[model samples]
Structure formats: structure tokens, C-alpha cells
Target: MVAKQYVPATGDIVWLTFSLQAGRKQAGRRPAIVLSPQSYNEKTGLALFCPITSKVKGYPFKVILPPSSRVTGAILSDHVRNLDWRVRRARFEMKAPRQSVAEVRAKIAVLLGSGMSSG
Candidate 1:
């Protein structure tokens, strides 16, 4: 008997949670594309860690691609896509009515956690 694997469907929002090998938690979520059944050369995996800001937050995070992970190109390309998406989403969401800069900063801090930089 063969064991079945769970693969995410296209347009599915998946959360990628990470913790440092030494034991610190970092988590983020993004929409994923399922590329397994479509192409022969394409490997199976979900998009994770798509950054939601224009500039890199400088927080240390790692993407846990499975052992079976395979890509035709550089992994950084995937990272770029995730980062772009994150920034766009953040910008769109930050436009709240009558909100001050400080309020925005505080909100971001709360969402990203205390250690994350405001600027």
C-alpha cells in the first residue's frame, strides 16, 4: 500500500509557520499555487513566506521546503514573488481612515511582533 500526500490546491491561502532551530517562532501566510499535476518536470510545493512589504523587514525567517522540493530555477525567485505579494498586501491594508503614522507603526508592530523594526 502507498501513502497519499496532501497537496494544497490553487488559490488556497496557506500559512507557513517557522521557528528557529534554536527555538524562536516566526509565522506568515500567503496564497499558493499547486504545480504538481500540471507539468511533468515541475515539482510539487506550495508558495511560502511571500513578503508583504516593499522593503525587506530584516527579520530572520526560513522557508521549510520539503525534502522532495524541486524547482527549475533559483529558490530566490520564489522568495521574490512572496516578498512582492506581502508588500502589496501590506500597502493596501495600511490605508485606514484617519490613522496617524504612529498608529500605523503600532499596528504593524502588533502584527509583526515587538522585535520587528518599524522603519
Candidate 2:
């Protein structure tokens, strides 16, 4: 039997093995926010996300997120990326509030200097 894949939704946080190391691009399991809409995930089998990290140093580009399932972190909008099951692990330990995700997306748009609305 094939294992089921977790379908991430916009505003949903998920745990994924993202590339953190520079040279070798080592896989680092971390939490990230799903930035793409459901349609994109369904049609392309790909997902867009913004990596979340605990290394917040009052950075202007980072958006501080509320604690989820005892995991406290901030969304690194500057490190936004796209991925598929090759790097995805599972959904977030806990889902974030809808409002929190919206705020994160707004911050990301500002960082990108794009007026594009969130999906």
C-alpha cells in the first residue's frame, strides 16, 4: 500500500525537510507555512512555503509567529521556496491560527516589494 501524502493548505503550517546547509544542501526538518493555494497544490502536485526558524533576532524581514504545539518560531519570508514530497515530511506539529498566517503572508509581500495579493 502506498503511504498517504499530506496535502498542505494555504495558511497551514507543515513540517518539511528543507535545505538548510549551504554547500552540500543538507536536509533540515523544519516547520514552514504553506503559501500556495489549494488549486496550485492540486494541479501541480507542488507546494510553495516560507521556512520558519527560531533564530529571530528582531530582523526586519522575519515575521514572528505564535507558538504552535509548544513550537515557537518566526517565518523567514526571505527564504520562501517551493517543494514536493521529496522534501516534505508531514503537517505541522500543530496548525497555526488563520489570522497568523494572513499576517505572515502580508509581511512576505512587503519583503518581496510586490503588491500581489495572497492566494
Candidate 3:
């Protein structure tokens, strides 16, 4: 019996084998928050996500995630990337609140460093 594949939404937290070191290395599984829309994820089997880390590096792009049932960490917006489903290890039922998700999006906009227009 094959397990059902779950398409993660914009606020869902999931564990995935993320690429690190300038995309030259694949690291151990870690929690990440989905940043892309579910429609994109469903169509492409890929999504943009920001990593959750325990140690705060004080980066301007990092946003703090509120504690859920299991973990509390900062969303490293600088590390956000589009990842394929093959890298996904597990999905957590835990979802980031709407406010946190909005904060993460704002951080990502800042990280882009282009002063994206709100219009």
C-alpha cells in the first residue's frame, strides 16, 4: 500500500532534505514552512519554502515562528528556495498562523532587497 502524497500549502510546516551550502550540498531533514501557493505545488510538485532553525543568526530576513505542538524556530527567509517533492520527507500537521505567515512573506520581500511595491 502506497502512502498518499500530500501537497503542502503556504502555511504548512514540513520536513525535507534541503539543499544547503549554495545548493552544492544536501543536508539532513529539517522543518520548513511552505511559502508558495498550493496551486503551484499541485501543478509542479515543487514549492518555495523557508527553513526553520533553532539558533537565531540575527539575519534581517529571519522571522520567528510561534510554538506549535512540537517546535519553535525562526524562518530563514534568506534560504528560501523552490524544492521538488522528492526532497520532502514528512509533513507536519502543524500549520503556521496567518499572522506569522504574513510576517514571513514580508521578510521574504525584504530579503529580495528590491523594495517590492505593495501595489
**10 residues in a row with least lDDT, candidate 3:** 19-28
Return the TM-score for each candidate structure. Answer: 0.22, 0.75, 0.79
**Pairs of residues clashing in candidate 2:** none
Ranking by lDDT: 3, 2, 1
Instruction: For candidate 3, give the lDDT.
Output: 0.78
Per-residue lDDT tens digits for candidate 3, residues 11-102, read: 99888876556554336688888988889998998998887888876677778876554658788877777888555655765788788789
Of 1 and 3, the candidate ranking higher by TM-score: 3
Candidate 2 structure quality by residue, lDDT tens digits, 4-116: 66677787777888755677432588788788887888678788887778877787767777654456777777767878834466564666677777777777778777766
| 10 residues in a row with least lDDT, candidate 1 | 71-80
Report the lDDT tens digits of candidate 1 across residue range 1-119.
99754333322223333222345222343222221231221242322223222223334331223333221111111332322222323211111122222333344346567777667
Scored by lDDT, model 2 comes in at 0.73
Question: Any idea how many clashes model 1 has?
Answer: 8
The superposed Cα distance between candidate 1 and the true structure at residue 35, in angstroms, equals 10
Error of 3 at 24 (Å): 8.3
List lDDT for all candidates, in order: 0.28, 0.73, 0.78
RMSD in angstroms, candidate 3? 3.5
Residue 26's lDDT in candidate 1: 27
